[model samples]
Target: DQQVKQNSPSLSVQEGRISILNCDYTNSMFDYFLWYKKYPAEGPTFLISISSIKDKNEDGRFTVFLNKSAKHLSLHIVPSQPGDSAVYFCAASHGGYQKVTFGTGTKLQVIP
Candidate 1:
């Protein structure tokens, strides 16, 4: 079974709005959570991440929040722009980033 899951396969958001991507995990052993943005014909680039010890982490327009008790996490992008459109993947790993399990991915489209 997939340990990490992204229930929504895709999302659409208007430009200058907020885009929220959600992910869920079944394995509690995961201590670290990460989000990646992938463009067509390119590798996924690390966006933002949060440690299990922290509830939230923010960088510029991107913010990641972890709810360990609920085994849930979310990525929020404020003032979404067209360039922000990409497939976002949620990943989890334990024991210092040895092996990571990735979700199916959520495609985000920001309408201009």
Candidate 2:
């Protein structure tokens, strides 16, 4: 069973709009949640992240929200641009160890 899951396989949004991606997890020990953006044939790059201690974290146009009780998290991209088009993966890990679980991924397409 996958500990992390991204229900949406893909999402489309117009340039300069908002894009929202959802994720869910089953592990209660997950203390850190992260969102990574990957381009075709390229390695995933870190995006926003949230700690279990906080309900939300934001950086520039990216924001991550975590709901511990619900074991849910979501990523919001404001004013989405074409450059933001990519596959986004949701990941989680408990502190200390290097074991990390990742969600399948959600492909976001920003149309001009």
TM-score of each: 0.98, 0.96
**Candidate 2 local lDDT, 18-107, one digit each (tens):** 999999999898999999999999998999889899999999999999989999999999999999999999999999356778999999
Off by over 4 Å in 2: none
The C-alpha local distance difference test score for the whole of candidate 1 amounts to 0.96
lDDT of each: 0.96, 0.94
The weakest ten consecutive residues by lDDT in model 2 span 93-102
The C-alpha stretches of model 1 lying farther than 4 A from their native spots are none
lDDT of 1 by residue, 43-107 (tens): 98999989999999999999999998899999999989999999999999997747879999999
User: Which candidate's TM-score is highest?
Assistant: 1
Cα deviation of 101, candidate 1, in Å: 0.7
